[model samples]
Target: MSDDNKHDRDTPTWERETLQKLVLATVREQRASRRWGIFFRLLTLMMVFLVVWAYFDFDFPSLAEEKIGPHTALIEIDGEIDVEGTGAADNVIPSLNKAFSDEGAAAIVLRINSPGGSPVQAGIIVDEIKRLRAEYPEKPLYVVVDEICASGGYYIAAAADRIYVNKASIVGSVGVLMDGFGFTGLMNKLGVERRLLTAGEHKGFMDPFSPQSESQKQYAQQMLNEIHQQFIAVVREGRGARLKETPDMFSGLFWTGARAVKMGLADGFGTVDTVARDVVKAEDVVDYTQQEGLPERVLKRFGAAVGEGAVKAMTHAPIPSVR
Candidate 1:
């Protein structure tokens, strides 16, 4: 009786252990399969994201070609007008050349919407406009101010035979300004030392971290005065006998479209369409602004999207404006 009972008990215990092992192995296999499925899904999503980005970043030219039309060249002057930034000379000058050269173009219109930038850049554009106008005397170049046209912007506008502005347009600043921040006090407070070197005595005259010397200030004032004189000369030349030369005209102050017209800062208050129709007697005006081709736009969009996505993923705060 004891031998039979012992054999039966051993058989049941062995069977139970084998069944338990099989169940455990099945659960482990299911978990592994689920993990691999999740990994594949994530990988597919990433690939799709990459493909979309490439599509936008690389196909701008094709899109532009499709959108371009005859009898109209759209020269866009949007955003800040700086040499290295939006209103770079390289970017706008070439387009201007193209606009002037287009034989089919009836009239070239400068659609300006800027708050002004570097004087050098503005001067270059103004000279080019004058030269081009002289070269093609029959073309009838015109400037149409959109939102704001101040300082360097007005300087550029004065080149045109006629300037058009919206009723509420901020038309003129008629001034020059060179801005910088002095950090000498801040550096001294923080016990930070400046190690700037220069060969000439006045090479670092405008260095923001150092105290400004009286001689340096005087020299800077002289330079600014010279620039102001140059500006006055250009304005007088462009305005001709039309400028009234009042006390406040060139005092670094601005005027609205209505006031500007009364002060002879602008020709008349009108819109692009009005000038094109009434003054030029041409119903169709061409835009000579060069635009980024489809491929460039796509690339830019993709890059921006990727950058924005990365910023979001990392939860970084947006950078503050420098201006």
Candidate 2:
């Protein structure tokens, strides 16, 4: 046998050895790459799942069980008084009940900052406040107006034992309004026709594109007057002899906090701190407001911006609001 052949038989050829090592290395690299790829893909899927879970979280806010010493309970009525918003009856009343029911809560201070909204919502809150007060007469409830408490805000505030306000705060708009835009002229200019059909007469009542009928106008005015009277009656019952009534008091006019105090619309100028420290005699103020969770806020805002806008645009009817 040749020396080279004899060496090849004893030990593998160098090329064959190199080739085998190269193939093994390639296989190991490929396996590692596939394992890393799978790991990354799984990581991405887990992150996506977490994001979706957070976004679609179904948990709504409930009153938390808090055990503490004597503190002034604070409930906030911030933003427009509506069914879904922060100042809604559902949100406010529950907090009120919890505050009034709390053994550690010395008193409740309802801090309000709103421009008013649905009269129905405001009325419901007012009724609840009245009921709660009557049920818990010893636990006093006061209102501390923030920026502006007008119309529906004031309606809720009126039920408080006392209302405090900052000197520059806006308060008191004792009136009802059903306001909307008339698009008839704009539609005419654009040469766009509005087609409205209904089974009942005045079914499309106060349609912005259509000319307002005289009878419908009178009916709307009468309804507004009746609601205004109801508002006036509430103010009278709440303020008692404190209110300095004027002819234009219920004429949809607003006033400053200082002016409100002078007109007997508010009790005096104070804040949540002052009311808690000085009036309630408890400096530690505990918030009892039922806050909207992330999901509720996201859904509500999305719906209002898209769906509510579309409905308002199509309907073009005046919404009876106290503003």
Candidate 3:
């Protein structure tokens, strides 16, 4: 045999060990990958569970579960009252329902501190309040104002049995408005031409980029006047004989609580504690406010912005703030 053939015949075959090592390494990698995947899935599930729990359970849920003793049930409206906000009708009404249904609840108090927001949202809350009050004639609903309760805030307060406030609290703004940008001047300065095309002449209505017509201006004003009249009627119906009406009561102006009392827009001066202790005749006060949780609020604002924009387009255009 040739030398080359002889060397080939003597060579050791190590391919089996090499192939075994390769197979073992591949199996270890797959096992590690599966373990890590399982770990991450468990972590994600735990996080989701915590967020859901927090969203449904109020900050201090123990307060809602206290012993059934005489107590005043409290629901707070602390920020701007918007349909998507914490003080929205959906948020407030559920709290009100829980308060009313509680066996030990002697009375219900709405702690309001807001500069006001959407009139539509306020109207929904007011209607619900009236309905709840009618259903629970034994439980009196009261509003205790903190710093301010204007426009829509006052609208909701009007449905309450009484309104109490501090001397410095801002009370009312009873009106509606439609504010928007008129960019005709900006466009003129910029030499920008707006090329808006629509099938209906008024389809491009209220477009800021286009020139505003006199008729459109008057139409907007008339719509505002109609909403203002509706607001006036609600206040009148709520305050009844208590409201000392004036020419400018619904002129979109705000007033201090003391002046509001003189005008009969508010009932008297008192704090939440005092209202509960004196008027409610219950010393123990329990908060039943359905506060928005961090995770849920974060999810809503971040996730629902796009969805809400679509909803708003289908619904009526954004009404000017009633602030």
Best by lDDT: 2
Residue-by-residue lDDT tens digits, candidate 1, 41-153: 99999999877776554434455444444343335667666544336566678877887777665577777888877677777887888898889887866778888888777
Q: Candidates' TM-scores? A: 0.66, 0.77, 0.80
Q: Of models 1 and 3, which has the larger TM-score?
A: 3
Clashing pairs in 2: none
lDDT of 3 at 242: 99
Error of 1 at 206 (Å): 1.7
Pairs of residues at least 3 apart in sequence or in different chains that clash in candidate 3 = none
Model 1 residue runs over 4 Å out of place are: 1-74, 84-86, 293-323
lDDT leaderboard ranking: 2, 3, 1
| Whole-model lDDT values for every prediction | 0.71, 0.88, 0.85
TM-score of 2: 0.77
What is candidate 3's lDDT per residue for 188-254, written digit by digit as tens? Answer: 9999998876776676667778887887778888888887787888899989999998988999899
